[model samples]
Target: MRIKAAVLHASPIAKPYAETRPLRIETIELDPPGADEVLVKIAAAGLCHSDLSVINGDRPRQIPMVLGHEASAVVVETGAGVTDLVPGDHVVMSFLPTCGHCLPCAEGRAQLCAPGAAANGAGLLLSGAQRLHCDDGTDAYHHCGVSAFAEYAVISRRSMVKIDRDFPLVEAALFGCAVMTGVGTIVNTCGVRPGQSVAVVGLGGVGLSSVLGAVAAGAERVIALDLSRAKLDLALSLGATDAFLASDPDVVEAVRAATSGGVDHAVEMAGSAPAFELAYKITRRGGTTATAGLANPNARISLAPVHLVGEERVIRGSYMGSCVPARDIPRYIALNQRGRLPVEKLLSGTGPLDEINAAFDLLDQGKVVRHVITF
Candidate 1:
């Protein structure tokens, strides 16, 4: 099948992406779904920071790739051996394709599924097949097994979670990555309980989701931090109890003074070394500092060993918010439906696929939270 998709032939493209136009919207060939796979019509896809990292060369991936992962789709066809889902079923694409039998999957840690990691790194379907081909006849790589920037995609069943048809599918795209990672990191990884104090460093789509998660978890104080004052104000409007300028030289001191030492759980979602440092510094004694940010592979942060030993501080890495997609996506969606999560407030706006480059520019400038490309 032939479809239009935003394909990145090269990375580290000069900024003002509207000018360099890193992603070329081109017609590409898509193969039929193989056994254990499903063909999906993309309903909506979100432009996430992770995708921006790839465009700016911060996060490297195989090039000439269809660059989208956070998406909601409707099943158009099911491949052999796929019985649980049928055509017309709405679904969310999980970036990691969890094989139920993998060690991590068996242990209820599907986010760390070994096969899923290998597949994503190799840019192949979980079954180890390539389904995309560029105009030049060279095979293109899948982005995190989703390649969702296109109108249609052939994905492993493992990469999809069926959703109720009644829900607004456009809003559902967020659950795939931003909502899952941001909200999951707080509720699942940080385990914020009622009356706990939480501070979220970074107010992108994911970070703002953390704010909503903290409020939903019943945190006594939800602190939001970001370099952008607009984002800070938005976070405040979304139930955050406090807001701070991350660039403020005395920001850490201010946070500590406000919380009487620091927050119970500090989450780093900015995907920067400095953000992690701030999150760590603002954690109360014996508190946890968690990071779900996908920082550049080469990026590193400095930490004091004494703090970990003396204060019993915990530093944990949260991938996909340490969530099991099959279990957590639906749970989070339920919360959104009931107005407990209120994730819909995070939507910056939506546009057509042709304006994707402009959308990326908006995201790069921190002018929007989560912009969806509607099909």
Candidate 2:
């Protein structure tokens, strides 16, 4: 079938995406879902930094690829050997497509599945094939096994997490990435307990979501840190007890003073070396510093070797917030439905695929959070 989709060609494109226009919308061909795959007619998809990373050449990938991973869709058709889902079932797409039999999947750490990583890097489904092709006969690699920046997507079953039919698709799209990564880091990765002091170092969608997660988990104090005052205000509205600008040289000290000697847990979602360092510095003794940000592949953080032993500070990396989509997506969806996880506040607005280039500009400037492309 022919579908209108956004395709990213050569990277290192200039900014103001509207001018350079790295991601171009074009008519493309979509193959039928192969075995263990399903055809998802995308309802809504979010514009994540990860996608921008490709266009800006921060995270390079095979050229001529469809770019989009966070999305909500309806199962238009199921391929052979697919029994658990059928036509019309609403679902959210997981960027990682777990083969279920990989070593990581067997250990309940599907987020680290090697096969998924390889396929994502190569821009193909777990089956290792391109289901999308440009009009010029070039095969556009799939992005994170989803390639949801289009009208229709052929994705693997492992990437689909079925959700309630009544759930709002636009909001459901955020669960695919931001919510899962943010909230999951708190509840799953760090297991933040009630009355604990937590700091979220970044005010993007994921960081903001972490603020809500900390509050919902009963954190005694939630410190929201960011360079944008606008984002800080939003964080305060979303339950952050205090807000600080990361640009402040004494920001870490301020956070520590607010939490009576640093927070018990600091989640770094800014995806920068400085952000990671700040998170580590503001963590209380024996506190955990968890990072889910996708910093530059070449970026490095400096840690005090002695502090590791003296302070007993723990540092860990969180991919997809250490989330198991099947187990966590439903739980989060329920939370959002009940008004506990107000993810609705995270969405800035929506646009058609044509305006996606402009949306990328806003995303680049951190002018919006969770901008969804409505199909």
The Cα error of candidate 1 at residue 110, in Å, is: 0.3
lDDT of 2: 0.92
Error of 1 at 248 (Å): 0.8
Model 1 C-alpha lDDT per residue in residues 1-375, reported as the tens digit of each score: 999999999989998988889999999999999999999999999999999999999988998999999999999999999999989999999999999998899999999999999999999999999999998999999999999999999999999999999999889999999999999999999899999999999999999999999999999999999999999999999999999999999999999999999999999999999999999999999999999998999999999899899999999999999999999999999999999988888899999888999899999999999999999
User: Tens-digit lDDT track for model 2 on 78-167?
Assistant: 999899998999999999998888899999998998899899988889999889988888888999999999999999999989999999
lDDT of 2 at 155: 96
Predicted structure 1, TM vs. truth: 0.99
TM-scores of all candidate predictions against the true structure: 0.99, 0.99
Clashes per prediction? Answer: 0, 0
> Whole-model Cα lDDT per candidate?
0.95, 0.92
List pairs with backbone clashes in candidate 1.
Answer: none
lDDT of 1: 0.95
